[model samples]
Each structure stands twice: as structure tokens, then as C-alpha cells.
Target: MKRRQLVRGALAAGLTTPALAALSGTRQSFAQALTRPVQAEVSELEAAAERFSYGYQGQAPTEVLAELVEYFDEKIPPLLDRPQSVTARMRLCRTAGQMAGMAAIVLGDLGERTEARGWFDIAARAAAESGDQQLHAWTLARKAMVPLNYRSPREAARLAEESRQIAGTTPTAASTLAAAVAARAYALSGHTDKARDALTDADRFMERISGEQRADTWLGHCEQKHHVHLSHALTALGETRRARESQDRALALSAPTSSMTRTLLLIDAAMCVHRDGDTEQACRQAAAALTNVSAHYRTGLTHTRAMELHRAIPAEHQAEPAARALRQLLAV
Candidate 1:
């Protein structure tokens, strides 16, 4: 069976558009065509799902989660019967876990506590099954963020501590994730010292990341542009000064390529300005951020952040008009 043929079969079997696009390169499209198959179509689908999840991480979580759920519902079940295939099952589990984590993040951002917890549970289970310690630790850290966002920093801190312990046995990427999560948890929990320390650890971990080891899962490019993650953590900590600094650093690093990243940096810069009481500058940055946001399939979290900023600016400010326009765009 040719690759296209297999893809057609998957599509006929209910694969989503993104899932089908992910399998565009395979020699044979369906699971039956594996001459020396190392993994199953479901596994490949899972990996693609993971990659997509990472790609939309900084965007609105609701949109990303919706897409993920659609893919899982349409594409995952068909591959479950092939459980004897270790490589396939492993891939599927890992992908499923990552998606669950992404979903948890979205639900948490939207203040859907019950839904967030359920997604976290799914993520934990999937991570355990896949034996991907990094994914496991990362998901746990994300789980911690729910409470932190909800203003219960104490519980967030505890979860962050647990994540840190789990990450200790993992690789640099996982460790960085743990550190970032801990930083946010500490910042929200009012442990400024611990938050700064965790941020430092996260920075150190990023310094050690190599090009070859870079993996492209759905959370942006994990290794190379870690400054964005740091900026996000700083922003969560209410250290707008540090967040702006980090955002500047990320922009400098991202320049000359990747419009998506640059737009995100602009948004972060805008948020920093907003926090600093410079409504004008903040509105300008938000307007610039919308240039990119308008062009892409924004996730729910990004939209919410934009909305929060929109609500924060005073009507008397000169930039209110622009801010209002941006908010209107986001609403669409």
C-alpha cells in the first residue's frame, strides 16, 4: 500500500485533517502496509498530535484542546486493537498523555477546575503507561499551574515540588519544565526567593540544551527558544520588569526568523508594559501582537490573556481605541 493510500484509509476510518497531514510522508499509509514497521499509524498519529499540542502551547488552550479531542476521538480508537505493537502503543500513549496535559492547561486557564483535574489524571495515566518521565514531570508541573492560576499558591507549590523531584531523574528539557513550573508556583504562592531560584535553574538548564537534542513537540520548539518560557514564568510571578527583560531577550534571539515567536514576544512585552502601568506602551504592544494573532489559529489561553489586557486598560488612555479594536478582533 502506498503512503497516500494508507492515509486515505485512515481518513475513511475517521482521521482528522491535521492527523492526516501528519502522515503525509509515510511510505505506506495504513498499518497493514508495514513491511518492517517500527511503529503503528496510531503511534505516528500520537506523535503528530503531541507536536501540534506543543506548536499551539502559548496560544489559546481551548482551540488547541478542541482540535486534540477531535483527533483523539476520530483517530485513536482504531489503533488500540493493535496493542501488541509496542512501538505503536508507546507512541500513542505518549501522544495521548501530552494532549491530556495540553487539555489540562486549557481547562485550568479557563477556570474549569473539574475538567482540568480530569485532564490531568488522563495525562498522568498516559505518561505512566508510556514511561516517558519527561512528559510525566511536565504534565505534573502543568497540573500545579491550575491551582496557582486560581490563587491557591500553596497547593501549587506542593505540586511544583513533586514535579521537581520527578524531573530530577529526567533530561534537561524535563528539568527545565520542572524548574519553570516551580518558578510560577513559587511566584504565585508568594515565595519570591524560591521562584527566582527556580527561574535561575530553568535558565541554566536552557543553557545546556543542544541543537541535535532539540525535539519538536506541541509546546513550541522546546530547546532553542527557552527564553519565552522563562518570560511566561516571570510574568506569572508578577515580575513584569523581569518578564519584559526576558521577552526582550527572547525577541533578540528569535529575530530574523519565526514570525510566530516574534509576535508572542510582542504580546509578552505588552503584558509587561501593562503591568508597569504604561497603558499606552502596553496597548501598542498588544496591537502589534494582534497582527500575528489575527493571522493564526489562536488558542484559548492567548485569547484570554489578550482579553485580560483589554480589560485592564483605562478608557481615558490614548491607546484605548487600538486596544478596543484588538479586543474586538480577538472576540472573533
Candidate 2:
């Protein structure tokens, strides 16, 4: 019974918040049309954008988000509007989609759901324009994060499935992530069989990816990230033992200065521990997950996880040593 409650509660943590600024690039000046330099510019900017996503937790996410906004609303449009070679236009459009996707992530991290949604719409449109099936699926799957965190798991799962279908026989890292998320979302919605099936699908997708396949970039996915997603899904299904295995692997690969991804993995592991009845240990892990990072970086997403962890503790243990330690941080 406790396990069932824990599963539901773990899957249920979410929030709704305001979005980002408007798209401002439509009026920006350009070098007239797409050229080799324009292509190179997109490439360089994308590299920086990838690095930006991996920023340390204490880093100012607001600054990077503003930068992405600049690119999306100002820098990239000129390149997109002017005529170029068929191949060049497609390449430029893919870059635009990538930038839009990255921007949406920043907005989401900032708790700006509305802004994220708009950016995702731009990315999906860009994907269509670029004629990249992978990008289209990636956009769909990536956009699932907004609803996965802020709305219902059922809706999130639906998006994940759509992404998988569009991904077809050749799944990219992003599509693989969509499958992993589908597992978690299905578990949250009490579809045990479906959850396991989605997890299998995720594993299959993971196997096909190679080191150079653009995994975990601004528009990529990686093994460590896959493990984190797996841990969350397994934890949501009350499979603590399996969840811990994946959690340890994810933590092992995570950088010390990791951002939301690491924190989320820690919280999920702690929640799994909490479900297994080790309230003290769970509290400590959960508390440390928040404490290791600067207070300003603890967005609503992490805050909600902390609160959920606290609530999961037995009422009797709420005042216990580790629980007390965790409780104190909650007010911070």
C-alpha cells in the first residue's frame, strides 16, 4: 500500500509557471542570404549552445536562456528567410530547429512553461521545414518534458508514443529518451505492462546509438542521461532495487558540477529509498541533493521534489534526525 502511494506521488510531482519573452528575430538584419559563412555561423553557435545546456548548477541559467532568445528571436531568422541551395536551406533550417529546441529547454529550466511551449512550436515547425524526421521526432519527444513535469503523465506518454512512431526504425538519442520517458509516464499512470514495454523500447533505442551519434548535446542524448530516465521510471514503478542500479550508474557518470539532471537523479534515488522504508537515509540523500547546489539554482522543479520527499516520510519520523536535517533545508 505504501509502495502504491509512493509510486503515484513520485509520478505526480509537477508545477505550472509563466513563459519566456517573444520571438524577436523576424526583424534582424542579415548578410542578405544563406552562404557558407552563414552555415559556419550556425555550426559555431550550435556548439556553444550544446555546452550551454551542460552548464554547472550554480551558473546563471537566466543568462544562457537570454542568449538562446537572442539567437531565436534575432540571430537566426535572417539566415532562414533568404534563398540558398536546396541542401543549404535544409541545413540552416535544422540548425534553427536545434536552436529553438535549446531555447525551449532553457525556458523550461527557468520554469517558463508558456515560453517553452512557443519555442517548441517553432522547433517542430523548423523540423518540418528542414525535412529531418529525426529532428521532428526529437522535437516531439523533447517537448514532452513540459507536460511530463507540469501536467499529467498520460498526456506526456501520448507525446512520447507519437515521437516513437515518427522516429520509426531508426531511433535517435532524443527518440530513445522519449521512450524512456514513456516508461516513466506509463508507470505513473498505473500501466505496468505498458511501462515495461516502453522501457524495453528505450533499451533497444539505446543500443543503436554510437559515441559520435550526437548523444546528450543541445539536441542529443547520452547513456548517462538514459540511465537517469530509467531510474526515474523504475522508481515510479516501485522497483527500488532496479532503480538503485540505474541510479548508481547515472551518478557515476554525472559530472560534479552537474545541473538539474544530477539533482533529479539524486532525488529519484532518495525517493526510491524512502519507498523502501529507510526514512533516515532517504532524508539525508534527499537533503544532500538540494544542499550540494546553490539555493538560487534550486528551481521550482527541485523544490517540488524536495517537498514530495518530505511528505513521503512517515509522520512519526518527520522529526527524526535526518528528517529534521532535511526539514531545516526546506525553509531555506
Candidate 3:
């Protein structure tokens, strides 16, 4: 289907118009017909999903991610029941699930939390049917994040534990991802000891996995970004000093291309500094971050985090020149 038709279908399927508009950054034209059989490799879908994962870092349009999900959705059914395609079909389903999960993440980043939840369900079901345990675990972890970020930490922690259970003893990248989120949920809920233990588990699992693993899952290797998340959890738990240290490590370790991640970590760092009683420094840090953000990332999750920094500023400090600049920057 063409992009316009896909948008119409999404609306017809009950998605709000505003939500569709928020996600529409991809190209409008699709050269290949949906039902046509092509010699596409499973790796292509994996790669696409990986690219989509980094979309937050590089400012990919929400619409582009929507198109990717649509492409994967159309391609899955045609390849499902071919007699000799059993193995290929399984791989296809797993890839489709990963694509769906990635799209859901994008939607969440765009602040369309309700729609993101539905896509997460779609991804989890597809992954489960494919019998890909790691993918299933990843999907559950992704689902847990919806609550972790916006709703109840108790639910998020429960789902994260379930994801870890599904992951079992396997020390794959997916398991580490689950552990990291579980840590965050625990921290958010004030279970400091549990949060610390899960943080340790995440680090241990990450170390055990040699080389890059699960490049196809689109969660990417859990290294610096994992630490960045750890810092976020630490900040939530009021460990500002430790959080600042972790944030420094994450920023130092991250690739220069990961500006989005850097900006996010910077925002977290600003929060830490503000909590540490350096509101001027926090405002300066946030103002610097605003300079690097692209329009695509300016509105959703980024905006939310910026608002957090704004809120962290003391009422007395709000009129400071740096704080005034931060307010102006985030107003856009």
C-alpha cells in the first residue's frame, strides 16, 4: 500500500489523526507491491529495525518508523505458509516482531503512549508465535517500559521480572536489556536494594556476552546506553553523585554520532546537578543540549525530559539568565 493508503488504514483501524501525523517522517512512495515475492534477506529487516532503534539518536521521523512497521506487516502474511519456507517463515516472523517493537518504541518517544502499547502487544504476540525466546523477552521488556515511564512502577517491575524469567539463564543481550529495565523500575519504586542487584546483574550479563550479540533484535548492544539508563535510575533514587559519574562514563563511551543519546544523558545529568543544588549549572547543561537537538526529536520524549529539568529548577532560580534561556529553548 502507498503511504497515504497506509495512513488511511491506520485511521480506519482507530488510530487518531494527530497520532498518525506525529509519526509520518518516512518517504511517501513504496516502489514494491505488497504481495509481490522478492528475494529479500531476513538480515535486511533486522538491519532496518536496528536503524529504527537508533532513530532516536539520529532524529528519524515518526512517519518513517510507521512506514517500516507497515512494510513488515504487509510482508509477513505472504511468507507465512509456504511449504518449503518454514524456517524462513519463522525468521520472518521474528523480524516482523522486532520491527513492531521498534515502531512501538518510536511511538512512545513521540508521546503516543496508548498507540505504543497496542504495537507492543502486536510485537509480543508475533514474537511468541515464532518461539523466539529472546525476542519474546525483549518484547515484554519493551511493554514494561510503557508502565515504567508513564504509569506504575509496580507493574513495570513485575513485567520486567517476567521478561527475565523468560530470558532464563541465557546471558544474551536481551537478558541484559531486561535486567537494566528491571533495575530502573525497582529504583523508581524505591526498592533500592533490588535496583542495585539488578544493576549488577545487567553489568555481569553484559560482560559475559562476548562480541556483539543479537544484532537482529534492534535493542542494540547494551553498553554505554545501558549505563545511561542506569544513571537515570540512580538519579530517580536520589543518588545524584553516582548518577553523575555514570552519566560521565556513558557520555565518554558513546559514539559521536549518538547525539540523541548524548542529549538524553545530558538532560539526566542536568537533573542530577539540579538535585545536587547547582541549578545554574543544570540550566546551562540543558541549554547546551537544546542546541544539538533536531526538530524531529524536539517535541516528544526530549521535550518531556527538558520539562523535567525545568521543573527541577528552584522557584527562586527560575528567573536566572540560564534558567530563562532553558525555558525559552524548551518552549519550542
The TM-score values for the models, in the order shown, are: 0.66, 0.81, 0.79
Q: lDDT score of model 3?
A: 0.78
Q: Per-residue alpha-carbon lDDT of model 3 for 179-297, expressed as tens digits?
A: 98999999989999999999899888888875666342246655676677788889988898888888988898877756667788988888888888889998998888878766776
lDDT of 1 by residue, 87-181 (tens): 66777788778777776766775568789989998998889899887778778877886775565778877887888788783346667767877
TM-score winner between candidates 2 and 3: 2
Candidate 1, residue 56: how far the Cα is off, in Å = 4.2
lDDT of each: 0.68, 0.77, 0.78
Q: What's model 2's TM-score?
A: 0.81
**Sort by lDDT, best first: what order?**
3, 2, 1
RMSD of each: 11.1, 16.6, 11.9
Model 2 stretches with alpha carbons more than 4 Å out: 1-37, 40-58, 314-328
Runs with alpha carbons beyond 4 Å of true place in candidate 1: 1-39, 50-67, 81-91, 102-116, 146-155, 169-171, 211-213, 219-225, 235-242, 252-264, 274-277, 287-292, 295-299, 306-332
Model 1, position 56: C-alpha lDDT score = 51
